[model samples]
Structures are given as structure tokens and as C-alpha cells.
Target: MLGGAGVLLGVAAAPAQAAEVSYATECIPPAAAGLDPVQGTTKVEVTAPATAKVGDEVEVVWKFVQAASKNPDLIDLPANSVQPSGTLKAAGAQSGDIAMQGPRENPAIAKGGAMVLSDMKGKLKLTTPGEVTLTPDAYAINVMSTDTKCSPKETVKSAATINVTAGDGGSPPASPDPTEGTSPPPTSGEPSPSESESGSAGGGGGSDTGGSGGGGGQTDFTGKEVAIPYACKTPIGDKNATSPVQINAKKDGGSYDLTVQFKGSVMDSPADIPADSVKPSMEVVLGGADKGKVHVEGPTNSEAIKSGDPMEIPDLTGTYKPGADGKSTLSPGVLTVKALGTTTTCTPTKSAVSLTLDTAAQEGGAAGGSAGGAGVSGSGAGGSGGGLADTGADDGGMLKALGLVAGTAVLLGGAVFTFMPRRHASRKAP
Candidate 1:
């Protein structure tokens, strides 16, 4: 009697098993809650081109949920946890995009970190044309800048594991997939995603037997909100001080206001360096990305550093919004600097300036550590002439160079023409 009941249940549940995949999704920002995510989940489903047959358009799905903490610690935050989930389609359709949806950054001063979203789906594609079989392997999901160390097209690596192999019963492996940890071997790993979607211009109807193939293997969707772990990650009180430190600069330490240039390089002499140490050099950058529109000033909007003394830039704790007219007043002891980034109201208790002095034997470097006991080695000394005298080339440096070249060329050409013999043919002898 029990056997009969079990058979009846199995038959009834067959249709349900064939339904599309679904699951819960939990989004996270590592420390936003002052604890690891205690309850969350993420669901993933795959889509393929209509033309693909059931066998052709393979898909995969993943579902996850965060567990509540039963621990007694003020709050529970788990790290390095794993919740395994999989789908048949995910394994079959290997030559396509794989993606994940969410992550968010929290700006709470009490709990702030980098906001980031891991879109694992974008990385799927065919390395070669045709049906490329995908297999599970270790992978990473990462954010990338326009740098040489990353793949431009795929930003997310959805599957850190894959398994692709022929299964018995006229179908691929069923639940508890045996192909775990292995993927169909790729022909070559040289930047495979670039050419996967367009199909082979060089070959036809090739078998994705061991690689990527078919169409619409990947999908793109909004990335889940996530905070970058390192965004504004510097410690609250850390200071970034520069070299050839000045007190109050005149005209932002320049010839005029709205144009302070800090020469970021220092002259170095090996003779000045101790035999036990390496000569130090300046490689610091000062000024804004749009260096033309920025200037230095003390509290009260008094243009330039008139004091010729070191200024202690306080932490900015208020909102600072620059007016359309590009003018703002600095609170006393707070340095007001306008640049291209977001308007920061807090004064920089932590300031950074590039030192041009030789670091020959200077202890604690501006880079390796603090500026403590560091020497700005030069006879030119502080206020030798002016603090910011060699800070940097003015924003007008490029324009000046161009003007000089053009003027010199014009003068030289005129002189050459005047000195050359003029042919005054004798009244056109013809």
C-alpha cells in the first residue's frame, strides 16, 4: 500500500520538476550592518535564443539564502560561507554570458566600505565559434578599471565551478551532477569571450562539442547595488601630507589666485645621499585633474597663502556646495580647495603635498610611511625663495611653450627671407 502511494506521488510531481527554475536572492555589503549579512538570498535563471532546441539551449539556475545566526555574540556575521545551488541549463549552455544581480555600498560613517555589484553573467561567451561546451572551474568576480589586467567585455564571472559531461539515460547527468569541478576542456584560453557571440566567420556549424557555440548564450541586466570595499577606505584620521611643505601660500602659492601649481619633482644629488641609503626622488602629484580651475586658500577666502607658513587643513564636517560663480569662503584653519571631484565640506586634517626634496637618508617616507623626521634635502630650504616656488609648473606652462615656439619660428623665417638674394631680372629681357 505504501509503495503504491509513493508511485502516485512521483507521477504527479513530474510536471512540476520540469518548470523553470526559481529561488531567493540576498544582496550584501560585507560590513554595512556592523555584521555579516544574517538573512539574504539570490536567485539566478538562464535564458537562451528561441531557435535553440532543448538540447542546444542549455541553461542553469542558482538559488541561495542567508541563514540566521544562532550565536550569542552581539550580532552574527559569517564569512567564507557557501550555499551550493545549480541548474541543468547552466551546465549545458557553456558558451554564453553568466551574471549575478546585486551588491550595495553603505555610506554610514559608522559602517562604510566600497560598494560593488558582482555581475557574474557578463563573462560567459564562446572562445571559438560553434557549440562550446562549458565546464565548472575556479573563477572570480571582480570590478575593473580601464587597466591592462582585466577583460573589458566580461566584468562578472558567475560560475566558480562547472561540470560538463555526457550522462546516461539518454540525458546529461541528473541531480547531484557527477561532472562537478570539471568543465569541457577549452581549446585555448587566450581571451575567449571576444569572438563567442558573433559565430565563426572562419568555420560553419561546428560542434561546440568541447567549446562555445549557438546564440544568445549570455544576458545583461542591471548590476545589484554593491559598495566597493575600498571606496573611501582610508582610516578616519589618516593624513596625506606633501613635501616642500609651506605654511601660507601667496596666490595659492603662485603668481595669482585660482592657479596654484605645486612643482611635484625635487632635484637629487647622489653625493647628498648616505652610502647606506638610496637617493630619494619626487614622484608626487598635486593639483586637480582639471588643474586649471583649482587654487589654494586659507579660511576667509583671502586669495593665496599670505602667511608663508605651514597650514593645518582641518577636517571638513559640513556640506560644501560651490556656487555657479566658482567662489567660496574657507572657514579659518580650514583650507578651501576647489577641484573636479565631489564638493567635500570637511577640511583635510589629513593633507597631501608632493615633496621635491631628495629622500637620500630621510626616514619614514611620504609613501612607505609618515613624513615624520623626513628631510626636504635642499640648500634651497623652506622659504629659501618662496615655499611653493618650485611646487610645479603653472597651468599656463603648455600654452607658454606653444607661444614661444610659434614666435621663434616666425622670427627665424623672416630673418632668412630678408637675408636671401632677391632675383630682380633685368626688365624681363624677353
Candidate 2:
């Protein structure tokens, strides 16, 4: 989570009495109520749109949300469009207003049930645009979401366009969540007990010891001695707009019941989950132009509890992109969930229970089991059909724009370009 200090850092670095700059996005809609969120799409627009200046960036974060009332009418109305096939196209006056150079895209996922929802979030890097000078400009900055029977609205919260004083290296903060200041309600299930970190810290401490992610912990006879950090990641090319978070639970001195817990984000709406390609996990499951394809799985424990011991769950693994320094950099664009673990539901008989992974036949021989590998292939040590690869997320050439071509003599002859909005912005709300 980006903290208030980060804003302070930006403001402190800003020149005293800096340029007058502000920002807005067409992320939300006017009438998103009474929707079940089957599918939806999201696009962006800017006001007085122009090429954004450097130091200022437009951030976007997209996720899935479920409506309180999952009416057949609402659910059938495109239960949340999330496919990462969106675009921030150029308009006559729109192109020049916001800067577009090195526009780092960040996409994240959060779990929103019928009572949960996802918000449209993206950050436009207010940088230098070609053939454009530094000055305040007006662009339409329109965000569009459409599909068959899908909600035709775009601006979720309105005030879509904003004015930012460019060239001063200043960017605007994200639209705040009205419920942010309020305390979040607790969940029903018993959470795994907190583990003492060799060097640990967390919560609203302004800082916490960054521990390893997913399922790696010690489980003794002590109830559930394992404490896994709820960490999340975004896809590559993301400019760090938002992140995916997960929580795992384990019982010590018990039969192998590895229950990995994960948390999804609450969005301003629920209709954008399927169309916009937003998910609760950092791992990408569907196929894409540049991201290729991913097989995902859920955390599981094959055996029932027997004695007191912490059971181990498959660790969530993917490619870790490093910064320019050659070391691993923790940002949105550099992260990707290569493979997801599959969850197998086996019946329980008396004192015995079995588990297996529900494998994908198309991907090849996979069995039913919970937990995943940390490998790009998602097979784990055993291999196939889930998230968590041995190595980090791979550059599978999955990033590319879609296009249509002519037939006949057009075989590698003339190339036609087709464009669509694909990635969700990862910039966090300031």
C-alpha cells in the first residue's frame, strides 16, 4: 500500500509555490447501482487533454466487484468486464493534453464478492509527448466501458479531466475511497496466528519488516503457528498503480490442511471484472498478446489434520522484474503471476481424506491438488496447471496489440493495425 509519506515526499520535492496542477479520470459511472457485475469494460479520457508533462503521471487500477444484489437481470448484464483489452486512444484535442511517453501501465486484482467491487484505476505518466510543448491544454479525457447489454457509462465518479501544472515534475493523487477512513469489518474464518518475524513490522506502523510471501512458515503443535504475509503483484508493463494481495492460513501439529488465504480489492463498481481483465490474484490466467497464457490454482492441503505440525502450502511464484540497478525492484510493471495452483476438492470419509489438482487436459496430464508451483509453466516440482513457478514470470512475448489484416494478396503484404484497451493501470491512488 502507498502511504501518506509518499505524497509528502512528492510535495516536499516540489518547488515552493509550484505550478497549479490537478487530475481526474473517467474511471467510474453514474448509475452503477443494482448491477450484479457479469462483465464490463473501462477506457480513459482526459479533460483539456494534451500530452502530459514529465514528473506527472496518470495512474489507473482496475478490478472486479460484486453487487449486493446479484439479480439475474443484474448478473446477466455482463457480470463485470475484465479482460485487459482496453485502450487509451488518442482524440483530436485529447491526444496532446496528456503526456504519453513511457506510459507505464499497472494492473492489479482484488476479490470482491456479491458484496464487493473493483474500481477503475490508471495513471497517465504526465511526460513529454512528441511535437508538444509544455503548457496547460484541454483534452476530452473520456473513459468508456461497453459490451452487449453491458453498462454504457464510463465516468464512475465524474470530473474526468484535471489540470496539472507540468514541467514541474508534479503528479496528482488517486481518487480516494470514501470508506478508507473507516475500520474494515473482520472476516468469519479464524485467521492463522501471527508469527514473530526475525525482523518484523506491519499494519499502520508507517513501516513493517517485508517478509517472504505466500506459504512459508513454521507450524508446531501451537494451533496455527504459520503467519504468511498477504502480498500481491501486478502484471509487467504496469507503472505500479495497484497490487494483488493474498493471505494464507496453516494449523500446526495437524493433518496437512494447507489453507492459503488471499484478499481482493474493493472497487467502485462490479461490472468491470470480466471485460477489463482485472483479477484478485497477481497471476494472469487468460491469454494475452504480450503476456501469453497462464494456468492458475488455489492453495490447498491434500491431507486432513492428524498431529500438531504446520503444513506447507505451495508458494506463489512468478517472475520478479528488477529495477535498472540489476537488483529486484518492487514495482507494478516488473511483476507477473506466471502460474496459479489448482484446487482439488476430494470427499472426506471418516478419518481419511484425499486431494488432487484439477488439471487442464489441454495443457496435458494434470491431477487434482491444491497449491501451485513457483514456475512459469505452473507445474511446480510435480508440473502443470496452476500458478507459482520455480523461476520468476517469464517474458513470453505476451504483450502486443490486436489487429485485423486483409485477405488474398495481403499475406504478409500489407499490415493493418487494430487497437483495443488491454492493460489495467497499476498506479496507486496518491
Q: Number of clashes in every candidate structure?
A: 65, 153
Return the top candidate by lDDT: 2
Candidate 2 structure quality by residue, lDDT tens digits, 205-323: 21221121222344311111111122121111111111122222222221112222221211122112122221112332211111122223332223332112232223332421111
| Off by more than 4 A, model 1 | 1-41, 48-258, 261-343, 350-430
Q: How much is the lDDT of residue 287 in candidate 2?
A: 12
The Cα error of candidate 1 at residue 363, in Å, is: 44
Instruction: Report the Cα lDDT for residue 391, model 2.
Output: 17
Best by TM-score: 1
Candidate 1 overall lDDT versus native: 0.20
* Model 1 per-residue lDDT tens digits across residues 362-384: 12212222211122222121121
What lDDT does the true structure give each of the candidates?
Answer: 0.20, 0.22
